[model samples]
Target: MSDKKLALVTGASRGIGFAIAERLIADGYRVVGTATSEAGAESLQTKLREHGDEHSALVLNISDSEQTEAALKALLSEYGTPFVVVNNAGITRDNLFLRLNEDDWNAVVNTNLTGVFRVCKALAKAMLKQKAGSIVNISSIIGTTGNGGQANYAAAKAGLEGFSRSLAQEIASRNITVNCVAPGFIQTDMTDVLPETQKEAILASIPGKRFGHVDDIAGAVAFLASEDARYITGQTIHVNGGMNMG
Candidate 1:
């Protein structure tokens, strides 16, 4: 086995997930990033090569139960139990509740909420045996402060946070921590396409008056995954630029 610690990051093809995987690599972990498709996995592997060969990418569609189980089994067999697992894989099905079809709601909830449960369930036993691990689920500010056209997305994210807390309580005695990192409007492809007027409105809402960078969220995840945060669990670290402060 490699001397470096192991970590798994889901939805790591691009955007926030990619940034988190890169950050973990820089922090001296042997990171295994998951993408939804073979093509996405290949692209992720290529992009992450600049960091070094210490990290790898694999195809793992968390939304599919069978695929998730098989992929995770192969992953654990090859790389051993990960000391850190970041549930960053999520999909957004944005639509008003009235117009949102069942398919869209199910897609978002299954992938974003239930998918996380699947990943955590698969790893929990192994981590329990190891008696040392950290689980960081990526949440969104919308989960806490509901959005206009994202009922499904919001509900899923909110459910994620609750699940994290419960899991944290269950595993804390074994030295495993479960926490969340809730990000506000981060500047990604999803937000980049917004109209200038909409962007301005969003910027005005943020106390920082600027969009958050991927690195901002990455930094928080890195912290939660580190020894420094070993005592911290069942809590959320918000990187929302004061957008939804309590």
Candidate 2:
């Protein structure tokens, strides 16, 4: 309703996705977020009341093409084409390559890589019609640097950055920009699931002497999504507290 832009954040039920959605709403972007379940969608709505209904929630499995398409349609019909969209829906099935199954590989790729493709394909036309938009894909440091037991996840995320680069070029003439933010270890349920010894090892690796906070990653993403980053595209902004210079 205000002069602010509208944004859609996928996988916003919690963790980094929730942080991004919350910050976007606070920054005055009318936010619409998607979750994989009904309960998650309802929770998002409740969390969004502070931001008002100009921003809302949708429930859809981003990994499922049909469901993803339907969710985008519903959002567009209800709230119009968003000015910003963040593709943050992703899953991880960490295991050694020797033990990794086809299902594990497919699941990660479908959700992390192809799911983003689906959302963008669904939204890009609307964005083109508007003649402008900004998209930020949430990637992981493991994508670029690689990890021992995350071949599928790393591949999917790395593929995301590549996809974003190509799409950015195709849409730039239309005033659309695409970029990615790869976060290091950040406080989240997923990270909390790691064993204490592993957590300590991770912390020791970060030059900042600790794992990054959710807000740290959120701030980086917000910058990329803002007008201030209008001239930037097809770039990866790493928020890992100097873990990897690349």
Candidate 3:
């Protein structure tokens, strides 16, 4: 309705998702950001409103199949079809493989891997019909490097990258691209509480000598969503400040 193309970002209540939403809005896209709760959706709506009315927020629980289907149906009906879809919603349940329970593994896998499958499946048909779109899935360096206490999380992220590559190949004929942005050691509330010694150890591993900012990830997503990245598909853009360079 705003003449701007539509973009959808998941997990947009805070951190990298929020930054991606904001960056897309600034890029002149009508963005609909999603959160798992009404309060978070409302807060996101409020913050996004400061930018313009063309952007809004929704409550979407991607981990639930029925809910995800219903929410995506409503979104398609109301917003038409999104020109960009960013699968940035993910959850981590960290535990040593020996200590991890089935529930924890399932929870992480369901939310991180299967949940993305749901979102992409729900939108893929419409995108193919439109014959124009971009999909950017947020991944992590741990998916490649494999952290000690995050076996479940690592598997999910690794599966996600594989999924992106396969989907990109399937949709490239239709002029739609699917890709990933894998970040490493991003500076967020989760990392803020780490002890100074731990933080220093992390910094020492990065050639950049700093944790990445949300905007750094946002910039990568923005590029992948733009016309500039039209030829780039089925690739993972690493935004980890050279932390996991092969």
Candidate 4:
């Protein structure tokens, strides 16, 4: 095994997750990115191999407890234990509360909130034993600001922040840090489909007058995962380009 620290990033096939994985690899970590499908995993492996052959990808469906457990075990067995874990895998089913079905609510809650819980639970065993690690969870502006049609998504993200704070307290004595990176309007596949008028409105609201890049959020994650942020824990870093300032 390489002497470099191992980092695991979930939902890393594309967008923000992929960028975080790339940044970690550049920071001298041997990254293992996860995707929901085999094809996506293969693509992640190919893209990361450009950085180095030491990087790898796994098929992980965080909503599936059995599959998630097995994947984590396999990764641990192969790469030992990861020094950093990025819980970036999340899904959205946007709808007004009255219109939201049970399935939609359950799916969003399971994948976004509970899914993160599972990933952290599996990592805690190894990290607690090692007595050193970092966990960064990706949250959203909607979680704090509360959009009209995103009840489920907002709840899940809000729950994530609470979970991070509680977990940080639980593991701080072990030198394991848990924090959150809450992003605003980042340009991604999900945002690309917005109507031109909607995009303009979003741009006008941001003090920066522009959407954030994937690299912007990636940089925040990298900082929290690095020794530079050792003294920081149980806090949320908002990378929202002045969209929602305290």
- Per-residue accuracy of model 2 over 25-53 as CA lDDT, tens digit each: 88988888889999989988888877786
Candidate 4's displacement at residue 182, Å, is: 0.3
lDDT of candidate 4 at residue 7, scale 0 to 100: 96
RMSD of 3: 0.6
52-114: candidate 1 lDDT, tens digit per residue: 786788999989999999999999999999999999999888888899999999999999999
Q: Rate the local accuracy (lDDT) of all candidates.
A: 0.94, 0.90, 0.95, 0.95
Q: Count clashing residue pairs per candidate.
A: 0, 0, 0, 0
Q: Compared with the true structure, what per-residue lDDT tens digits does model 3 show for residues 147-189?
A: 9999999999999999999999999999999999999999999
lDDT of 3: 0.95
lDDT of 2: 0.90
Q: List model 4 lDDT by residue over 184-231, tens digit each.
A: 999999889999999999999999999999999999999999999999
TM-score of each: 0.98, 0.97, 0.99, 0.99
Check candidate 3 and list the clashing pairs: none
State how far residue 236 of model 2 sits from its true place (Å): 0.3
The candidates, ranked best first by TM-score, are: 3, 4, 1, 2
Instruction: Determine the C-alpha RMSD for candidate 4 after optimal superposition of all C-alphas.
Output: 0.7
Worst 10 residues of 3 by lDDT: 237-246
**Pairs of residues clashing in candidate 2:** none
| Off by more than 4 A, model 2 | 1-3
